[model samples]
Target: MADTITLEVARYRPDRETEPTVEAFEVPLRRDWAVLDGLNHVKDNLDGSLSYRWSCRMGICGSCGMTVNGEPRLTCATFLVDYAPGPVRVEPLANFPVIRDLVVDIGDFMRKLPEVSPWIVRGEGTSVEEGEYLQTPEQLADYSQFSMCINCMLCYSACPVYGLDPEFVGPAAIALAQRYNLDSRDEGADVRMDLLIHPEGIWGCTFVGECTRACPKGVDPAGAIQRYKLTAALQSLKSFVLPRGPR
Candidate 1:
């Protein structure tokens, strides 16, 4: 096994340069060391000026996501030993505006999140004495897969739809909407239906399915969109067949 590996990390200092550049740093190619571990070594020992986002290092935080070898991945979960024998390229997630180096501005995602009404909604809340809303295991399984989303935005990074149209609301937000929509305890699906059924919503998805391929948590945004599309079509059929009352 090689003792060392070269990491070509992307650097972007808006004040320093108009475009991003790569700076290489040789780091120990330890079997236990992840790509993120190499970056930390560079920051702590070689270059203190290096900038990136990381927390929990266990892949739960999802803040350490970056494009490694042109594929979006959790840097902390991708071991350096996997890309042995030479240099590895790491860059900011594609599609989103770069904030600094490996950190891309998530403001776009943040802004679009509320549009889906991600939280559980109800017409009325149960009293404190009534306890929290309860669900059977069967009901829990309905949306459980979507609930695994860590909001990593790797889906957005992998989405060609979002890259073509920034207004498309992206994958994570839509999957989260399904998270609450499928929840039996939540009654907000009606409120979200109009926004989701819009042209800029699920229709924007071309079903490339790269979003699902890129998701670290295994959340299937592409499947959610397809399900929602079927739902909308059924709704349209019902409305056409059964007219409104007293109209």
Candidate 2:
């Protein structure tokens, strides 16, 4: 293995540069060092002006997500050894506005996350005195896989639908909505139906399946979307067969 590896990091300073540029830096290619570590080395030793967002190197925070070799990945978990003996391209995630250098604006996702109401919503409140809403093992299994989302936004970065239409709610948000909708304790499935059933919501997804492939947490957002689509179809059919209010 080479002692050092080259990292071509994308840089964009709106105040200084009109276009984004790539700068190369060499760092020790240790087996233990990840792409984030290399970026830290550059910031610490090479360039102090480099800007990016990262927190909790343990991969729990999910803030270190970036495009490495044209794929969305968590830089904290992606090691340099995997792409050794050459330059690795580290760019800001796709389908988002660049805030500075390696940082991209996630405001779009932030706004859409709440639209689906990815929480257990009930009209009647159960007070603490009423006791916690408990779930059996079978009930917990309903949405456990979808519950693994760390909000990495890699799924968004890889989604072509979102790349084309900015209004698309993307994958993680929809999957999370499904999570709550599947929960036996939640009564707000109807509340989330409108937004998710809209053209730019779950319907926007073409099921390219890249979102699922890009998911590091193994959450099948694509499958979740398909399931939700089927669910919507069934509900629509049932409503048509059995009209509401009075016959």
User: Which candidate number maximizes TM-score?
Assistant: 2
* Model 1: per-residue Cα lDDT at residue 152: 87
- What's the distance in Å from true for residue 134, model 1? 2.3
All candidates: TM-score: 0.96, 0.97
Task: Flag regions of model 1 displaced more than 4 Å.
Answer: 243-247
What TM-score would candidate 2 get against the native?
0.97
Q: Best-fitting candidate, measured by lDDT? A: 2
lDDT by residue for model 2 (1-66), tens: 889999999999999999899999999999999999999999999999999889999888989999
Backbone clashes under 3 angstroms, per model: 0, 0
- How much lDDT does each candidate structure score? 0.92, 0.94
Across 1-247, the per-residue lDDT of candidate 1 in tens digits comes to 9899999999999989999999999999999999999999999999998999999999898899999999999999999999998699999999999989898999999998999999999999889998988899999999999999988899999999899999898899999999999999998987888798888898888899999999988899999988988987788678778878321
What are the runs in model 2 whose C-alpha is more than 4 Å off?
245-247
lDDT of 2: 0.94
The ten-residue window of minimal lDDT in model 1 covers: 238-247
- Look at candidate 1 and tell me the lDDT of residue 141: 97
